[model samples]
Target: MRSQARQYAQSAQHRRAPPVRYSVAAAAVPIVAMVAAVYPVPMAVVVLAVVAVARYGRAAE
Candidate 1:
């Protein structure tokens, strides 16, 4: 059986994680793939958008 402290650590670790957001977004990858397949988006445009969002998120943090 897990100890109380280990349980507390697990709970805290779950709450503190940032990758949960990434996991949810990752789940939408197939949707993005389908959309991209229907309408071919430029690679440069996608890279620029991702970079812009990353910069914005970092700045907000």
Candidate 2:
């Protein structure tokens, strides 16, 4: 009975694990794009491409 209680506590700990939250970098994408846009279309395109790649890579992982 004591062993079973210990096993139940371990499983409960796993179940209570926190959800993954987005980092500041992940949250800054739109801000980066807006600032990058003031430079030029080519630069904006590059910035957007980089952001997209980063976001997709993160989601894939």
Candidate 3:
């Protein structure tokens, strides 16, 4: 019973980290887009492509 309880607690602790990571990532994306917009045309496009690839990679996981 004690081992089961410990395992549950460990799983719950692991569950908590993702929301903090996701929220920070969510916030940063817009700021990055805004900054990207300030760049000359090709660099802005490159930034957008990078963001897209990053999003795709995360989605795959």
**Local distance difference test values of all predictions, in order:** 0.59, 0.61, 0.63
Candidate 1 residue pairs that clash: none
lDDT of 3 by residue, 6-47 (tens): 686569668764444444565567666777678655776767
| TM-scores of all candidate predictions against the true structure | 0.45, 0.34, 0.39
* Cα misplacement distance, residue 51 of candidate 1 (Å): 0.3
* Regions of candidate 3 where Cα sits further than 4 Å from its true position: 1-18, 41-61
Order the candidate numbers by TM-score, best to worst.
1, 3, 2
Which pairs of residues collide in model 2? Answer: none
Model 2, poorest ten-residue lDDT window? 17-26
Predicted candidate 3, C-alpha RMSD:
11.1
Model 1 per-residue lDDT at 7: 78
Candidate 3 residue-wise lDDT at 50: 64
Among all candidates shown, the one with the greatest TM-score: 1
Q: Write the per-residue lDDT of candidate 1 for residues 6-54, one digit (tens) a residue.
A: 6765686688753544434544556665776688898677667556655
Q: Write the per-residue lDDT of candidate 2 for residues 1-61, one digit (tens) a residue.
A: 7699568656865887322333335446666678776765577576777777677657755
